[model samples]
Target: MKRRVLIGLFGFNLLRQSSAHHQQHCLSFLPNPIKHCTSIRQSLPQGAMPNNVDARTMFSHIIKASKLRIISILMDNPCAEVIVVPVLSDNYAYILVDPDSKESLCVDPAEPRIVLEAAAERNVRLSAAFCTHKHHDHSGGNMELQRLLPGVEVYGSCYESVPGVTKGLSDGEIVKFGNLEIRCVKAACHTVGHMLYYVTNPGNPELQPILFTGDTVFIAGCGRFFEGSADMMVDIMRMLRGYRKDTLVYCGHEYTLRNLEFAKTVDPSDSVMSKLSWTERVLSMNMPTVPSTLEEVCTFVSSPTNSTLRFLISFQEFQYNPFMRAGDLKDAVNATSEVEAMAMLRSMKNRF
Candidate 1:
């Protein structure tokens, strides 16, 4: 009698598993079907399905029934929205809104009123403010924004003296706004406590990552070394270069035309520069020339060798940058190292 009882228990367990499998298959065929059948299987209560039905035929029928529903579900969610708000003179502030949640975060809001107005116009509730550094032009509106939207979190570098900072962030720290993830990168050069924000959509291949480079980097030029050394700037540049090639860069200012003009002085014969210069001139009259990819910037400043004006369309500006230029300048001032070159360039730019 004991042997018979043990066999009976074993058989019951097999029957339960078979029933669960059959239920999953039946659910697939049902009208108004659930999304992700795997999830449905895991959510099933014990003993939900009987073991007598044929699961294979049910699964096939479910697939045929749900084809249209699957397509409709896949088409529902769109990419998140990023709105650019121009602030003082050339400074820019960005408002990022999650498509699903409608929750938003502001980046480097120099003017609180403008940011607030923009958010209101878009019907998004501003939830946080992310400051890149302590510069008044970048973090000036932090306090005002805090006052306007009470309880809205303010995030800034732990090392920086950002105004109205509620949370101090460090290098490699990750912050989330809905489904979007933002990675904080330490980029101390233009200022000692500067940080860059890299935003990405995990598990979503359709959306590309974007970089919010405050004042550390510009379109064709880099920020002047305000409180750091040339070596520090080099380190930051190298770090930025390691990001994914397709990453979109949204910088702090509308200095692309000016930076590209300066780049022309460095490599006058570059054909690509000539084309881009003209393009920027036309675009500036109507729209902003931002959201440039890392790949485009890298190509624009890549080092070239033994080429004519056409072949030299893309040339690295590092050696041409008074700060990154090695050896002697026209005045016989020698910069023996990369750091020295950057120092010399910074001093010259100050005078220029």
Candidate 2:
């Protein structure tokens, strides 16, 4: 039996509106032969909520309000699946599979057994592995998985030493898997040789792009600077901000709640955080709080002043640290440059 999947109508509306708006004002830029796409909508129960009421409803409402266009569909009842396998406390390993072809790829597999079990259960053949960075928790299973699945292609950063890495990927390198094109971008900061993967369905613009951000970025929080500097992180954020607003981001960890807790301190009056807190409560009970849009992450990372205060409050343990006494961050506080602000934040986090 094919289970019906209820897709939020937000993305559809955005795409429709954008296409219409572009057609009117910017016809030349708009590509010819635009494809009209439709998705199966989950029927809303009659009288589910009064249309005029502004009361909070399901998390789907939040998504609807965001008005983001659909980038990709994860499930169509056995057609394809993005299976999230939780391993080693808060780490997440994802399996992207096309059920019809029995072809699959595992991303950031921390534990080989867990990833193997997930593919086995789905009856899919693992053909490739993608590692975002060299972190033990993210690439630890690469070697083992390669051994188990002979000839499995493992791709990782050209700058980093990834175990069992058969092909080293440089920035802007594209790897094709069926209809999906995965682009690797250098996103150093958390690690000196960190890489971020962006997967897109170029043949179908209606499909959403997916970003596999290792520890460089997370929900409501960025990763700690271990090998790179605050400058690198700032650059990474700017680069990420350039991506399509609707791109769905799949980060490496389940740290949304904790990150939001810190965010609350930074902007106590932010309504978005409040709404997100509710959604986190509901979703975290059963699933990982991820697949956040690029726009959503920008919302959290923007406003250097707010972020500075947030970090100060959250990292009070490092308030008296010597690094805090340095005048280097003074320019950052004045917003002289975003790099300085990010540097200050990273420095504080390091001491924390």
Candidate 3:
């Protein structure tokens, strides 16, 4: 048997492969030939494809090098499986796997049945579950997952009462599922007990670190300040912006297009505008635009006026995301303080 995977800008078109001797009657790119991920493929009409799949679908298959990018090169029989299972409109529930041990964990699986079936598809059992926050959509499936997978380790924040958290984790706490070690980072503003999980594989250095940021952050925007003030957001943003430039980011929802669209209104620089166009192409293929590196989104430019505020703008190449430029926006809203700048930006974003 021979196997060949096509690597493109978006990721691999494993379903659209061919051999020199014969065109392997490969699976139709399901919904769209350009890029149709497994999850999105489930929604297509029984045996038919969609309309936008072919017509002007050039950019849809492109994984924008300027924005989010998937790790495909070093993924041959990798340590963990980052199975993205799309659920409930725009939410992404993940099933993480350690192939050697057959050990698996789920992140923010709000819908139990969908996640359980996704796990079944991979023939992996859920040994544990981590909820990024208490949001109903992120942790709603907790109790049921516990019911289905008895003795599963359910971890949540020490600050909130998560649905079925068998153990409560706090800032800096570390936990493991097989060879994957997850570091808990406390997040503020979106929710008091909001948490972000950072996973590291010491066994495989080539495999980049990954972060599960519930609603604390998005591709181009941070979460709305619901439970805290702008001051609190500044702290959270400061911490997240300092993450390793190579770290991969996965947020809760599919808000890349909307966030980038709003970001263009803030900077309108080639970076943001170009990313917006790229994201539009990604969604056109019904493909997900995620797993963006910290380097692509730590897009901030410091303000000369604010000497007290401290923010490390790591990726100067993409100094575009408005929320990342809190200090730089102080002058826009006549804000004398960094917190004031953040508040004004949030207000405008909510209305945008």
lDDT (0 to 1) per candidate: 0.59, 0.57, 0.66
Model 1 regions lying over 4 Å from their true place: 1-79, 269-272, 275-279, 296-336
- Give the TM-score (vs. native) of candidate 2: 0.68
Q: Candidates sorted by TM-score, descending order?
A: 3, 2, 1
lDDT of 2 by residue, 117-159 (tens): 6566545778899999998999888988878888989999989
- Tell how far residue 11 is off in model 1, in angstroms: 67
RMSD of each: 19.4, 14.7, 13.2
Q: Residue pairs in steric clash, candidate 2? A: 11-69, 71-207, 71-208, 72-208
lDDT for 286 (candidate 2): 48
Model 1, residue 257: displacement in angstroms? 1.8
lDDT of 1 by residue, 1-352 (tens): 1101000000000001124334210011112323323222232233322233211111111112122211000111123556667777788888887654667899998877777766665567788999999999999999998888899899999997889999999999999879888999988888888999998767464455778889987666678778888789867766766777657677898776766665455445454365365446435433445555555332211112212211112223333333333233433345566567656655655554
